[model samples]
Target: MGISRRATAHWEGDLKTGKGQLSTPQSGLLDNTRYAFSSRFGDEKGTNPEELIAAAHAGCFTMALSAKLTEAGFPPEALDTEAQVDLSMEGGPQLSQITLKVKAKVPGIEAEKFRAIADDAKQNCPVSKALSAVPVALEAELL
Candidate 1:
């Protein structure tokens, strides 16, 4: 069986000066949240697609890392992951890179083993697989 989720976006006006709203009906976490050109390209106080993608990648990779650790007999006590998505517009608008930073606490696990599992998780996570075309880098620390 396959699971599905949905979110909707509404935009009004042109691309440069346009305003938009995004919402996730099922979760309602984003209830018509605002996003615009300035918000995405400039440093404006609103959400952007890259930011949302980073958040989703972070969450998905963290869960995948947890599952990998558990399978390796080193269930994590805690895992903190941050995913940074880089958007470049040199040639055109493109998702250039994604960097993941992970700090994990797992008892009785050596740093080498933990790093190995984390590497595997980064390579095989659903989100990572989906974004395989983008360059992905990981900096994992066992704490």
Candidate 2:
């Protein structure tokens, strides 16, 4: 069986000046959260699509890494992953690049093995696969 998640967005007005609200009904993490062009392209204190994508990517990759490391018999004591998504507007606004950096603390795991596992997690995570059209870079550090 496949699991599904959903979010809804409501917008009013034009692109440059329109205001929007996003909601994740199931989780309720976002209940009519506000977003706008100013938030996305300017210095407005609100959430935007790119920021949400970054959060999703970071969370998905971290969970995948945990599972992969556990399967390799080197469960991580700690795992910190940061996903950065760059939006470019050279021609048009598009996701240009995604970078995943992870720092892990696991006992008895060689650096080489950890790197391989981190790379695997990066390559196989659902979010990474979903964003495959964009260039993705991974930096893994074993601590």
lDDT of each: 0.95, 0.95
Candidate 2 local lDDT, 1-143, one digit each (tens): 99999999999999998999999999999999999999999989889999999999999999999999999999899999888999999999999999999999999999999999999999999999999999999999988
Question: What stretches of model 2 exceed 4 Å from their correct place?
Answer: none
lDDT string, candidate 1, 61-140, tens digits: 99999999999898899999999999999899999999999999999999888889999999999999999999999999
What is the lDDT for 31 in model 2? Answer: 99
List of clashing residue pairs for candidate 1: none
Lowest summed-lDDT stretch of 10 residues in model 2?
42-51
Candidate 1 segments whose C-alpha is farther than 4 A from its true place: none
TM-score of 2: 0.98
Full-model lDDT, candidate 2: 0.95
| Per-prediction tally of clashes | 0, 0
